[model samples]
Target: MNIETIISKIKNALGEGVDKVSDEVEKSQVFEKFEDSDDKVAKILDDAGKALTSLFDTIADKAEPMIKKTKAKIYEGIFEEYRKDGSPYGETHEGFMQWVDEHETEIREKVDDGITKTRETILSGVKKTQEYINREVSKKEKPSDSVVDGSSVTDQKSSDKE
Candidate 1:
């Protein structure tokens, strides 16, 4: 049954058995128990939340440099597209670096979008990883008697000859 019903039953059982205190005292006691339970749950949730936030902050900090490096690599490829043609058509190294510096917002959005898409794709594959492994394992053929368990190939071959 629900928590409230269970608490009510407990309160009733307490009221029927106890004679020293009145109904108000029993209820107050039950309420106090509930408050104590709620406080414990809240504390646990608060601690978990803090830990999760810290983990995310740590991941973001570690990812920041890697993200900038990837963005620069992408920018270089884009810069190369214009450079292959030569002259004013392609951006000079300084011009390309300036462009990257100036378009920070756009670059960040693109990088974030790439990260989100990559995460989604990876998670989708991860969910099926166990199933894929199980399927492949099941499809494998069993070993013959000549290939005894724990025996080396040379030993198995000699035993087979015998």
Candidate 2:
């Protein structure tokens, strides 16, 4: 559910908790935020590509095999160079996006796998932390004397101190 629906529910539940809050919530607008620096970089790269293609086409002789070969070699050198990670065109965000787009299914599967692994790791850590806290708390809580006697432990400890 959107923030508007949540606000509406809160408004009805609160009834008249704060009329101004309800009115402000009713008039509130939600903005969609994204961190798509990659997309912006991709767009710039696409513009650059168009510019390069335009330059290549400006050579009025369009039918020469040598020109075609040279263009293909240049394109290959630019887009097919293998990076340290063994991925072609992975050096640039735009090129990496292109490679990912081409291998979308594989990349998506790997991403899902990574998320699952990460979730499992987090859950394991949380469980261990919870167990550690429980153990520490149990140690600190020393079996209350109240369990044996009729009085509470705090009273027993205060009486013993006196």
Candidate 3:
């Protein structure tokens, strides 16, 4: 082939190679852009999730006291209704209520004393059980007097026979 034709062919091949390389670079850039966008979307979603969780937490915090108050009111209403329907210990609810009101302090003291005595009795029982357990465990852990003194039962029996 002539030099000119050879040179033109080489130039054409180089140009095609450069075009392919450019296309590949463009494709890589597109892929990188998609990855960046996906990361940004994920970050935004995470932030939104966090914000929603915070909002719910704040709502619960603010609503908790109100819910408690409402529950207390409902319980009070139920008790009041029961009282109106006459849950009295004596003849006439008013007299029963008056008697209870008069002896409220004494009743509370008695109840408290009973609770304290019961707690003391339970604690005493528990302590006795613990002491018993400790004694039993210590007996098991210690060597017996016969074993410590190096006298086996058979040796003692033979000595007694002699």
Candidate 4:
């Protein structure tokens, strides 16, 4: 039965014990308090879950268009840079295939040029990084003493020992 019906039954069952009615009522009130607290906890958790989901959806919605725009800009830049020699690439898949077929030599040259430039740039950067690292390592190394004709300390010591 429902709580109110159970409470009413309890009250009726304890009729002559009316002096103890306050104790029964107190016990029921405590149980009702617990039930109310549980409902509040559940509602708070549900609200927090909904709020987090909404926040995630909002972030995704905001990012989608910007990501598309960035991708478009990168493609545009690549096309503009590579097609500077009046190439007839029309920014479509069919057009691109046709252009490739028609200007195979020019396309190959441009591709090779791009590859060469990229390799040179990477190699230059690597060389500079290596030089900087070597300089730093040399600076950190201890100075050697007792060097004769550009020989290291270990070699000199070994000769002396021999």
Clashes of 1: 0
lDDT of each: 0.67, 0.62, 0.62, 0.67
Residue by residue across 55-156, what tens digits does model 2's lDDT show? 777654564776587567644543443343377765776876687577678655755776689679979998999999889988886544544232332536
Q: How many clashes does the backbone of model 3 have?
A: 0
Runs with alpha carbons beyond 4 Å of true place in candidate 3: 1-35, 89-162
Worst 10 residues of 4 by lDDT: 144-153
Clashes of each: 0, 0, 0, 0
Could you tell me the lDDT of residue 74 within candidate 3? 50
Return model 4's CA RMSD, one decimal. Answer: 22.4
Say what the RMSD of model 1 is: 16.6
Lowest summed lDDT window (length 10), candidate 2 = 26-35
Q: After superposition, how far is residue 8 of candidate 1 from its true place, in Å?
A: 31
Clashing pairs for model 4 are none
lDDT per residue (tens digit) for residues 78-122 in model 3: 445446657555456675567557656865676577668967997
lDDT of 4 by residue, 67-87 (tens): 798668655655664467455
Top-scoring candidate (TM-score)? 1
